[model samples]
Every structure is written in structure tokens, then in C-alpha cells.
Target: MFEWMAWTTPVVVFFTCIVLMLIAMTVWEIRSPTVMRKGLLPIATTRGDRLFIGLLTAAYINLLFVALGEKMMAWFGLEQEPSVWISFALSMLLLSIIMKKG
Candidate 1:
């Protein structure tokens, strides 16, 4: 009852915060759906354009999350986590290469 809530409350709050942040990000991206559309004009006329566009959008969003998370951790003086940095670098590299041939 009350004893269980004492420990679970923090976990629930953490997840709730994450969900809220994700929702905010979604709204922000939807508001500016055109920025990530760059370099896709040539492929826009193709039948697979929509699919490609969606993939690129997903990549861009993931990259942003990784990059932003790293910055946030550093800004808050949190412990430097290797996995987070690795994910950030990997995301950036993949995004760079994927967006090249477009």
C-alpha cells in the first residue's frame, strides 16, 4: 500500500517524465516537418519517396536524442556513461553517411 508507493513513486515519475518529454519532442518535430526534408527533393518524385523520407526522419530524430542526451548529462554534471557516448557517435556517423547519397 503506502509502503509500496514510497519506492514505486520515483520510478513512475521518471517514466512519466520521459513520456512527457517524448510527446513534446513529437509535437516539435511535427511543427517543423520540412527541415528534415532537405536533400529529398530529387527523390520526392519516386514511388519510394515516402518510405525513404520516413526512414530519414527517424534517423534524424534518433541522432538528435543521442546528441542532446550527451549534452544534457554533461551539463548536469552526471557521470560520463560510455554507452551514451557510443550511441551518440554511432548515431551521428550513421546519419552523416545515410544522408550523403541523397
Candidate 2:
């Protein structure tokens, strides 16, 4: 409905921007990378580096939500349920594990 969309427009725009920026960063990394030298070896040319970048991006997003989450929920007329908090916490833990592996 028009009314529904009118309210969701801003949220959609914000998310879309975030997605686009992430895609751009990823493409840039793939195209060009800055190298770091350690001792007598170069250690920046690794797939793990890309994985780490993605994980860091994901963590930044999650932290952004967790930091301003309460306000966003209230703005959207969403209730702060305990189960939701628990799920968010679990998700963060899972993300941490993925980062650790990376």
C-alpha cells in the first residue's frame, strides 16, 4: 500500500545505501590492494584478508544495531522483547566465532 511504503521509504533507503557501500568496498579490494611487508615476506596477498574485511564489516553493522537498537525499535514501534535480545546476543556470538576463524 502507498501508506506502508511511505513509512518504510527511509529505512529502505538507509539499508540500500549500506549495501551499496559494502559492495563497492568489496569490489575495490578485489581490484586493488595495499601490501604490507613483514620481515622478508609479503603477507597482504591472502584470501583471509578479504574474509577479515567482510567479517569486520559485518561486526560494524551488528555493533551499530546493538548500540542504537533500542532507539530504532522505539522509532519503528517495535517492542523490545527478551527473546529478541537473546537472539541478537546469540547471533553476535556466532559472528565472533566466524571472525575468530578468519
Candidate 3:
């Protein structure tokens, strides 16, 4: 059914996962309310707030790695494909830290 859409499989999966996470969070909040807490981010945040910040951070991290990684790779004559994996790893680490500490 998604074949006609212009989005790649990864894009579709990413968005689908986001939608599912939002739904899950909504249900979780309905069941048990979240309390605001201060974290390393310097601002008090609830679950949703942290999630929003984490997603935005992950997107920016990926963009930066892709944009700068290409230039750096070209400068050093290195392969470009590994940058994606590196960015993904870094983003995942950041996301986990945010979820745990933020």
C-alpha cells in the first residue's frame, strides 16, 4: 500500500515509529500522569517535552553528520557510507541519555 508514496522505506518506518510512540505516550499519560523534573537540559520537562527535544536533537545530529561528514570525508578521501552509521550510533546514544537523564 505504501509503494505509491514517494517516501523511502526508512522514512516511512521512522514516521510510523514516531506516530506509534506518540500514541503510546498518550495512553501512558492517561494511565499514569507524568511529573515535571529538572535535568541536564537546564529546563524542567515532562515525558512529552523530553521526547520532543530528543527527536529534534536526533534530527539535527543526523543532519550535521551528513553535511559535515561528507565534506570531511572528501577532504580525507574516505568513504561516505560509514558516516551514516556513525551518526545513527551517536544519535541513539544521545537519545538514550536524554530519555534516561533528561
lDDT of 2 by residue, 1-56 (tens): 56755657668886797788668757866898544423211343343454455456
In model 1, the runs with Cα more than 4 Å from the true position are 1-7, 34-102
Which segments of candidate 2 are over 4 A away from where they belong? 1-46, 81-102
Q: lDDT per model, in order?
A: 0.56, 0.57, 0.87
The CA root-mean-square deviation of candidate 2, after full C-alpha superposition on the true structure, stands at: 10.6
How displaced is residue 63 in candidate 2, in Å? Answer: 0.7
Q: Candidate 3 on 1-102: residue-level lDDT in tens? A: 856778887988988998999999999999999999999888999988999898889989989988787677778888654458889889989987997799
In what order do the candidates fall by TM-score, top score first?
3, 2, 1
**Candidate that beats the other on lDDT, 2 or 3, i.e. the better one:** 3
lDDT of 3 at 1: 88
Model 2 score (lDDT): 0.57
Q: State residue 33's C-alpha deviation in candidate 2, in Å.
A: 17
User: For model 1, how does the per-residue alpha-carbon lDDT over 26-85 read when each residue is reduced to its tens digit?
Assistant: 685577553334453454322234334545665676666666776768787778633555
Q: Tell me, by lDDT, which candidate is best.
A: 3
